[model samples]
Target chain A: MTEAVLKVENLQTHFFTKAGVVKSVDDVSFEVGRGKIMGLVGESGSGKSVSGFSIMGLVDHPGRVVGGRILFHGRDLVGLPDEEMRKIRGRRIAMIFQDPMMTLNPVLRIDTQMIETIQAHEKVDRETARQRSRDALGQVGIPSPDERLMAYPHQFSGGMRQRVVIALALAVNPKLVIADEPTTALDVTIQAQILYQMQKLVAEQHMGLIWVTHDLSVVAGLADELCVMYAGRIVERGPVGRLIDAPIHPYTKGLIGSVPSRNPRGQPLTQIPGMAPTPIDLPAGCPFRPRCARASDICRTTPETAEHLPGRFARCFHPHLEDAA
Target chain B: MSVFILRRLMQSLVLLCVMTIIVFAGVYAIGNPIDILISPDATQAEYDRAVRALGLDLPLWQQYLVFLSKLVQGDLGKSFVFNEPALTLVFSRLPATLELAFAAMLLSIVIGIPLGLWAGLRPDSVAGRSIMAGSIFGFSLPNFWQGLMLIMVFSVFLQWLPAGGRGPTANFLGINSSLFTAEGWQHLLLPALNLALFKMSLVIRLTRAGVRETLLLDYVKFARAKGLSSRRVIFVHVFKNILIPLVTVIGLELGSVIAFAVVTETIFAWPGIGKLIIDSIFVLDRPVIVAYLIVIVLMFITINLIVDILYSVLDPRVRLADMKS
Candidate 1:
């Protein structure tokens, strides 16, 4: 296997609010190898997006990475000076946003943004940056890249704008890309196209990608590995196929079971009972305990992440066996 | 683009006609200027002669027609008080007002934007809070009072600057400028600073709010993720986005600044249109008063039109093509 391009260990990002400290990302660990994709899956408040932000060092005020080391090619990014981090950013690592408009300056031309992104990291001439920007747009399958480059974000449809955003992210050809639900706002057809393009680009460029999403179905086909988060913790993680085939954690099973496609067309979906606990005021021990069907007295204590199978790790007192599936 | 401008111009023309009627009617309604022009003790023949010379003997409608005809021919009527063409008087004082307005605008943009950026960037910090507090004071204080206070502190107290009046003037490119000499600048500084104080605070608040809102946007986070330096992210990505709204506010505020300068100019005795208008108001110089109001209204329309064009330039979303229903 290629050396891990990005490795996050025991990451904890907390929001220090007036009421209480919210552990947005707590002890979440994951690794994305070169030329591979890792899907960080969770519900809205599951800290998946926060984890991505922590990795990018983009967490704003009140929320901070209090613990954990983010390793990029064995270099610890946690305490790296802002200057050094900036150098690594855009140049070595990039991120895509859920809303393409969010990733675009509404006032600026697409070409100007892309070229500036290039020029921000590298001292390239205007023509070279412009050429690269044009090429990037074309790579994202934008028809008539030259014309599209001059157009503003509002001029394009949602899908095309997202394509432009993707083009911008890949413009620098960074080693790792942390995409926080980049396709969530896009239509299914466009989402699929973007995913396909991203996967293809990742493979062709030998880059690593961490695609954060709540929808398992979207990443199921694209991500090589899966990390399912509950509240702020990674509850289960393994190869995508293995985790999908026989999810050890009951929460993972519940998530998989709730998928509309997995249920019979006429039947009501099997939703996991109860909502995900708020990060600020979480129930002690297991965050999923209140909702877990297989939860027991042992769940009263925080479940330490342990290897439940040869290659699968799950943070659960009662691990479901392969035969149980 | 031309179509948009032409349409806007036509609308402005209509607005100008309506405004002219209103101004003409309103000025006539405010008691006859002839009463102030000629004393009550004056003989009937003398009064008749004054009235005839001033064209005040004509009916309101006929007087309006005469005024409009002269207006179309680039004559703003003769100032009853100054014994000069109203347009010439306004034009002569226009440079001073423009100079003061531009200087104040420059001060506001230079000082307010950066202060607001800093405050917005770290809103919870001590310095940020202090800046915000200062802006609140800036917004609340009356301009005349502030001007008086500045004069007291910087002029009367310190004796470092002049208290009032345009000290000396020099011709720059055929336009009389009070900013060319040291003594003239000293005279101009207090009024300009006083004028800028209110606008500066407004801009600071605007900038702070804009920056705060913009910081939360997706593109800003994406820019940071791309590993762009904090400087680049804030200045290039965030600043450019915030500039759209800032420019709009600044453009609109400029018209108000000129209008509000009446108070600042009065207190400082600056030889600007604002001061001239006040003097005209006291003596019931109807032509000058009417001309000033008309000029200000025209200025507002021109400024609005310019802002609309700038809006399209800054943000392609507001382009003429997109503006079509």
Candidate 2:
């Protein structure tokens, strides 16, 4: 892995609203290696999704990447011209949204959407693009691919629609895929099925996948490595097994503790004490300090993210590093 | 699909009956048309004979039955002023208005939607704000006033177009229409623009609002991430989604424009049905008036049916819902 599939270095995405500048993603950094499944774990407003958008150069107006180097297979994506950025999107990196129902244009047939995606990056004829679309559908395990291609988004059930969306993303054979909670809207069984298929796809294709989600459980089962975000920053990063078993950053600990399965069935679930700080009024130091029980006088400033142990990173003055032994 | 169409036609049939009843009652209450038709110095016998000949002497309900029965037999009555079949007169005038309505609609859709999309995409930009502000002027100005202003500017000042009247009409498929010739378009431009002003503003507002809301959706972000060019993203993804509302509004607007282009037609002295109806109303030409209204109702019914079909075409969800029921 001389060059990871995608590497985000010191990414800062800010929203300049009337209220003030909202640092939606502040000083976040991570990398997804070849065939690696990296979980970008965070609750709502934690910037996990924003980080994904930033990497794709899809940040809308009022919010922008002010600082960062999004090296996709070694080329810097930050401030890339629209033409160049578009060339990379879908061709080299694809994204899946939380809801499959909304992703495909409801008015268009499945073939039209997929064909358009293929033709957008490649100079293929309509029939060729359509064939690629059918192949993509088959790859995602869609039954009767030809018939499904002719169908519209609404014709597919929830899980089937998600599979179509995944097919759309994988159609281009991109080196990296950013999935923003693509399975969150499905039933448990369907979610598990999609996750398994996606994991299999990544391994077989040797392409990196960034799974952005708030569900630690889903990522715990899916991701090889994990980055825990709190208030627009990656507060901890490590292999999933070590990160979940011996979590460091306080927010990560609180998040892991709050999972319903982690707590005893008869007991009340662990709850984080405060709502996430609004990006506009983030504390001068650690944005999570107010909600952190481990906050001390020395934790009044931002701690640098660095490797505290081999291949382990955390931005905390007092990370639970006793497990490093 | 056939079942849906059958149900819609049944609904339209009931609506048509109700409309005819209301229109008949409303017109009957507008006072005696015979009074206006007869001269003040005409002999009593002459007046009675004239009334009897025109069938105005019949009771209102009896008159309606006569009218409805003749309608069922495909006779739409005769224009008292023109001494011709009411349906024939209307059909002759229809092409003028149809061409005008189509032109106006074309102008509104072609100009309105893209401007609205641009403004919505960059709400804070100078062009975006200016476009929004200009649409306020478009919708706020009175139709007659706008027609007068258009005539003043293009005809009076610029001398770029004709002041009033329909230009030379060429027969196309046995339908004499001025829209076939370039000189016809020059004569048409002012009146068409005037007729379209309000509708253009409405399309702009609705498109802007829809695009603004749809832009914030995860699907739009996903479309962008798929590396599609902004052109494809906005046109295919965003535009297709927003068109549901636009199609609904445009269908209703087209019907209204054709039915109510009275002010523009009058201002330009364009020989459309709007002008015909106005004159018919003044002379108390009951046959023509009734015929004109029926045509309008039919047009509205047809437009609405087309709208429903268009909805199914533009949004698969509508078609899916149709299937479920």
Candidate 3:
């Protein structure tokens, strides 16, 4: 197996708010190997984004990585000083946000932003940085890369802007990229294009990628592995194909079953009965128990992560068998 | 770009025309200037003669037409009291007022932005809270009262700076500046600081809010993930985003600073346009008053034009929108 570029162990990120402490990401763990993509699938407020933020050390005030180790290439990133982190961030571990505008400064030219991203880590001169920026834009399939570089974020369409942001992430040849719903806002056509470009880039560069999204459909074709989160914890994780074909956790089953394409046309769509529990005031034991159909008395006590099949893990009292379907 | 500017200039011209009419009508509606111009002991004949000489005897519409025609020819009429062309009197005082307004604006921006940026970064911190609390006081305090208080503290209590006046000035670039001399700066400092306090508070709050808002934006997070130094993230990515709103505020505030310096100038006995206007208002010096109003209206229009241009420069989105229109 390729070496893991990132290994997050028992990570816990909490927000200390006036109302209460929000356990946004509570004791979640995952690993991403070189040239592989890990899909972090969760609904909104499921802490998937927060987990990504914690690893990037970008969590703001009130929200902090309270526990866990973020191992980047075997080095613990948990308490790394900002100066050191600056050297490692963008240069080795880049992140793409849900909104391209979030990554693109509306006022700055695309070239300036991309070139500066390069110069920020490496001691490259303006000419070399500019050339690299142009190449990165071209790699992302932007036509007339030279002219596009001179344009600002606003000059490009939403899809093109996201492509620019993707280019910026890849500009420094990062070993790991954490993309938090980078293509969620785009239409299907643009989404496919960006996803294809991202997959191609990661494979070619042998870079590890963590693609966080709520849509399983998106991850199905893109990621090598899948981690399904409920509330703040990972419920099920396995190789993407196996997890989709036979989900062990009830929540995972519910999620996969609910996909519109999974059901026959003219049939009622499947949905989990209850709402996902709020993170701030969560019930003890399993978070998905309220919404889970197979929940039992054993679920009232927190389920331990148990390997049910080869290299597949699920936190559940009753794991689904491979032949259950 | 030139087309955009031309379009905006045309709009400004229309706005200026409308503003001049309102101001002309508004001033005339307040009361007759002839009441103050004519001495209490003067006979009816003397009053008639004075009214005729000042063209106050003409109908309001005719008076406006005559005034407009003269204005078109670069004639601002004569000051009833100063016995010189009203434009000359206003222009003579323009240097002093411009000096004060510029100094105050410079002081506000230089001190306010950094403090605001600091306070904004950690708004809940001890220093940030204190700065915010101070800003509230700055915002709430009356300019006249604040000017007096500053004089009492820095000039009377400390005796470190002068109490009032423009003090000694040195000529550079054909403009006399108090900043060139120690005594002039001392004299200028109290009023400039007084003038700046309210605006400084505004800038602080704006910057704090802007920083807070921009920090929450995804781009800032992406920048951090890119492993750019926190300084670069805050300064380059975050600062540029916040500056859009800041520029708008600064441009608008410049006009207000010039218009509202009356109180500070009065307290400090600074011989700026505000002081001149106040004096003109008291004695009903119609020509000077009218000229000052017209000039202020022109200044506002010009400032607004600059701001619009700056908006395009700072944000390419604005430029694109302009191009579309």
Question: Which one is best on TM-score?
Answer: 1
Model 1: which docking level applies?
medium
Report lDDT per candidate: 0.87, 0.87, 0.88
Sorted on DockQ, best first, the list reads 3, 2, 1
lDDT (Cα, tens digit) per residue for candidate 1, span B1-325: 7887788778878887898888788778888888887889999999999999999899999998998898899888999987999988888888888888988999999999999999999899999999999999988998778888999999988999989998788888886787888788999888889989888998999989989898888777776776666787788788877888888899998998887688888888888888888888877787888788878888998898788887777766676744641
* Candidate 2 CAPRI-style tier: medium
Could you report the Cα RMSD, in angstroms, for every candidate shown? Answer: 2.3, 2.7, 2.6
Q: Which stretches of candidate 1 lie over 4 Å from their true place?
A: A322-325, B321-325
**TM-scores for all predictions:** 0.94, 0.92, 0.93
Q: Tell me the tens digit of each residue's lDDT in model 3 across B191-296.
A: 8899998899999999999999888776777767777778888888888888889998999999999998988888898999998898888877877888898788
Worst 10 residues of 3 chain A by lDDT: A316-325
TM-score, candidate 1, is 0.94
Q: In model 2, what are the clashing residue pairs, if there are any? A: A89-B227
**lDDT of each residue in A63-157, candidate 1, tens digit only:** 99999899999999997888888888778888888887567877677887888889888999999999999999999899999988888888898
Provide DockQ values for all models, in the order shown. 0.72, 0.73, 0.75
